[model samples]
Target: MTPGLRLRTAREGRGLTLERVARATRVNTRVLEAIEQDDVRAIPPRPYGRGIVRAYAAEVGLDSDAAVAEFFAQFAPVPEPVRPAPPAAPRPVRFRPAIDRRWATVMIVVIIAVAAATVVIAVGRRVLERRSEPPAVATTGVSAPTPAATVGTAAPSATPAPPPSSGVIVVLEATRPAWVAASVDGRRALYRTLKAGEREQLKGTDAVRVRVGDAGAVRWQVNGRPPQAMGRSGEVRTAIVTPSTAGSTN
Candidate 1:
């Protein structure tokens, strides 16, 4: 008997209907019936068809591998058809704006003019600042006092020392660009960014408080004391100089 007949006979011997076999094997009832009736065209093609028959045979107590061999011996496998590939899409074109020669020339000239003006202003400002600053005092070398015209002339009495100035005197010198804000005696004194090599001196009766951005870029001194660094670079620091603390370094 054919493989399908053998499967159907085995299933019937076990009291299983086609519908019951279909449910157990997960195969459609119509396909199971077609297999039983030996209708090769009704089943799937080739390996798939053989696989379905194998499952059906195993579910009904027949040898699955042998069943597949026998079914394919009677109905050979059919090859899948080849399909043509779809065509590729076309690429898009990009457009750029047209440049005008007149506009380009005008822009170049404007940029040059602005740069020239900036340089001129910087040079002029430096010149004016130098003119406004106090000139350095020239000192002649020390010379021995002239011999007294007469032996009776006694050496001039020693010059007296100057009296101490009252009030706090704070000096800020910037080695680089730094933001500084200061107050003296509880009133605003100066609040601005100092350019490189700039110096400011402020006086206060009671106290002088100063705040700086870029701490290490600026050095400060109080009451003619030695200069001190505020902190490391890029650090923000504040200090209050009073008459009592001005002389002590801690």
Candidate 2:
């Protein structure tokens, strides 16, 4: 049965009033009524909505986890049709003239001759200058020890910091327009439609819950692994990714 119907039936069977449930759960009466009616727009956005539903289910003596799972499952977005890509256009050709072989050879020979002459002149000047210098007379004396060069002293090394709690990272890219919602460590991180070629990154230590309207339209990488296909075109997919299941396709 739908979560709303189940909740309503349970409430009626137990002879509980909306006001009574609201007072106990600390939720508004109108919000409680909206939950029983399964009105998505009237309900608050997640993770608030998820928490509210879970609390209500628990108050009604139902399995909170199952109720929350089934409640969100009924609201998965419908997939859109995929379109074919357009054809590519052709390119134009261009022409160029060739150089004269004889002219090219003469230019190369001139450059080589000039370079060789310059090198020879430089070496001859250096040799002449060295030969022209006067020789130094030999003399020796005891010299005092030189003081050690003084630079800044070293400081003690600090302890290395601990790693972040986030053990995994997820990158989502849209190849085509699609709707996506994600939660990191039970907190809502993303909730909006993505344009083609757009990308987002999410990190979580415990879990990253994701729901995609068009599974085939989005490419994803977990913990910097290679991008993997999610599902067939127009398929809806929902999954909770943890450190162990970060890179696995399943």
Candidate 3:
């Protein structure tokens, strides 16, 4: 039986009026009426509407699970037709130009000569400068006094520390365009229209579940975690990410 019908029948069987059920369940009378009448338009999308129906069913002593199942079944999506695959074509071989033998040898010789000249000039300049420097002497104009050589100690090395472990920020875009309820690690995150690039933050261990219509659902975990098939409303595409730990300069 449909959820609306089941709800209606359960209420009537219990000898309860719509207003009585509404008041007890804290659901609006209009919404309750809609559920009984199978007017799904009156309720919001699942799991928002699902919560309302569940709440109403619980109050009326109806089987909430059965009602929800029926509701989803009624709205369950139709499967798309599959298309035949196209025939694969053989890949064309690519050819690259080979170097001219004579020019290649000349180029190598020229490069070697240039490099050797540069090295010799650099070393010659350094040796000339060292030979030209005068030896250290006492400040007073007299016989040069030899100063005792002091042993120099090396300074401590300063190494940069590694960044702290700040968890990921995932931006999940819904493959199917629809209103969706997204959850991270089983927490009620948000119920909003799943636009492209919609983002959410989750710890490294958290799993992601997106319910896309009554037809499509997908599950993927953050940081190489296993994938799970979630209840579908529509198609879902997941992207893993690590958020920046640095504070914004702005």
Candidate 4:
């Protein structure tokens, strides 16, 4: 039987009313009903929801640990390992061409000068030959080749990246002051107050769950997923998180 059914069976065996348990445990009557009905979506998510089951089990004299375990068994299997974001592609290199313009202009002027000199020399030689003087023997030798200039430009630089987390990564960015409790793979990670603009990262290889004292005060994300507002300001909420589920307060 499912954890919810188990809880309901245990509660019925004890002849406890949902109202009686709610008053005893200080839990919501609706929540107690949801738990007995196997309506996980109605309860918070695992981990946090597991705590509710523990409290309920204790009130009804059941095995809290086993009930909590059964609640978490519904989640996906433990994650393998954390995966890092892919490296950014290298930036393209482009020459400005501005610095080489002066050199190009100078080369053009020298070519013009060389051509003019050659034409003048040829005319002079023809005139001397016409005057009955032996034509000056033309000397032919290759001019040295120009060396290629190298431009020294560095590749574009990138900013430092954030450190990698080794398990399912859950990020909580608090917009306003609030209380937050979180767990990963049933291991408690954080139970602290988060001031406005504060961020907390939690890790879970199996499953992660969180409870917010004030929903409107925080936004959350998992494994690089889009950030989601927890709820209206002052609303308390809970939800299960996995790499795939991304943990939604709704």
Candidate 5:
């Protein structure tokens, strides 16, 4: 039997409907139906189609690895044998719009500005001390020095230090393939498709916001607290999520 038939038979043996399986897996109902009917050609490109099959198999308590392997055996493209062609340099892999890259750049500029200001303050203090002293204060005689204006630095304080940092932390887990756009502290952070089982963590001193292609497919956690739902199934929605916003937006 084909891999599709095996999946169909297994699902039927447990007397479950395609809709029930789709709901549990967060996969589309039509995709689940097509898989069971052995009409997965309707799923378009083979790679994403295979991902759907793998996720579905796992959700149904099937041997996911074995099912995926069998699906690959039936559909995987055969690689072309190497020939005497010109050598090509390896391409760099890129994750587009990576949030941390921009975040690091902003932090570097702030640090440089702080260092420059500190240097200017230190140099000015030294110049002022040289100009203020009297020329007669450097007398060679052994007589007890007249009290030329004296300067004293204050002693360091013995106060307790405060905590290092504090901020809102946002976590998002994608149960299915969905388009996601996120911003942390009003700056664009992530804008791309989140594949199944993907997770993102964001920290912001102000706030975090997100929009999802399918709101129900994502689960969220804020500020190290308990997990909460995002929105209704298959709903395209945008929400202003922060430490305070916990419930789904339906």
Candidate 6:
């Protein structure tokens, strides 16, 4: 059976009303009704519609994963046949000349000699000009000394330092009817219900504590570490927590 049909049957079997299922799932009553009747038009787009259906099924004590899988099975499109591979690409061909390689070597040596001569001539002209010209005399009584050569004494250039790394932004929302509280670096964050597509940002340098119902508590470190347990609640809850570094920004 389809996921919507299965969900509806399970809900009815439990003697639960659409309104009761909606309240438990935190989804709209109309959406619950639409899923029960298999009215795809009433729900939002794909993934979102499937998520709502899953949430609703879970709330009504139905097999959520099975319902979701069935939902996709009923709605997902079939794959088309794979096309044949194209023909192999043509190989590149290289060509070599019959001329003597020594001639090419001689030409390269001549070019280098000409370039060195040009540089030597330029330096000689600058040196001769300085030697031929007389030094200027100062108008003041004191003679002005020639400045010392600046070779190998270049001034150090200033470079700007790089900015500190920014912390990650984690948005967490509940998928079921449950209260959620988050703590980052020992700071209490606001807790709220998980809407169908709600998001919240949590920032921290150390580990972050996320408490769901009395049965669910998961701690996440921002540095890609495994989740640790702080405590737990008795409902479906999710938390987005990021670890912070010493140089991380607030």
Using TM-score as the measure, the top candidate is 4
lDDT of 6 by residue, 1-250 (tens): 7667778788888998888876676556766777777777666545556778788878778778887777766555647955434334334334354344555656677667767777787687768644543333333345446566588886555465585455544445443343456666556775554443344557666445555532232233344334333234333344333322321311
- Please write out the lDDT profile of model 5 over residues 1-250, one tens digit for every residue: 9888888888888888888888787667766776776774545344555667888888767998898788667755758954333323333446466855765566677666666766776687657643442222222535544444546855454466584345667788998777678888668998777888999988886567777767787887876667766887666567665433432222
Candidate 3: worst-modelled 10 consecutive residues by lDDT? 241-250
Candidates' TM-scores?
0.34, 0.35, 0.34, 0.36, 0.35, 0.33
**Which stretches of candidate 2 lie above 4 Å from their native place?**
1-166
Which parts of model 1 are misplaced by more than 4 Å? 1-165
Distance from true location, Cα of 148 in model 4, Å: 72
Alpha-carbon local distance difference test for all models = 0.73, 0.74, 0.55, 0.71, 0.68, 0.56
Best by lDDT: 2
In candidate 5, which residue ranges exceed 4 Å CA deviation? 44-47, 76-84, 87-192, 195-250
In angstroms, give how far residue 133 of model 2 lies from its true place. 87
User: Of 1 and 6, which scores higher on TM-score?
Assistant: 1
For candidate 3, lDDT tens digit of each residue in 1-250?
Answer: 6668777887888899988886676555766787788887766666677887888888778788876777767765646854333324333434333435555556677667767777787687767644443332334435545565557955444466686455443334443334566555446676765544344444533334444442233333344344333343322332213223112200
- Which has the higher lDDT value, candidate number 3 or candidate number 6? 6
Point out the worst 10-residue segment of candidate 6 by lDDT: 241-250
Give the winner by lDDT: 1 or 6. Answer: 1
Candidates 1 and 2 compared: the better one by lDDT is: 2
* lDDT (Cα, tens digit) per residue for candidate 4, span 1-250: 8878888888889999898997787556777887787777666544556667799999988888987777767856557854333334334435467746765666677667767777787687657534442223444656556555557855444556574344567789998666788877767888876788999988777567788866777898778778888887646687676543443323
Name the lDDT value of residue 187 in candidate 3: 61
Q: How well does model 3 score by local distance difference test?
A: 0.55
Candidate that beats the other on TM-score, 3 or 6, i.e. the better one: 3
Can you write out model 1's per-residue Cα lDDT over 145-249, one digit (the tens) per residue?
766556877767656658546688988999877678888876898877788899999999867778775678788888888887777765666777766566663
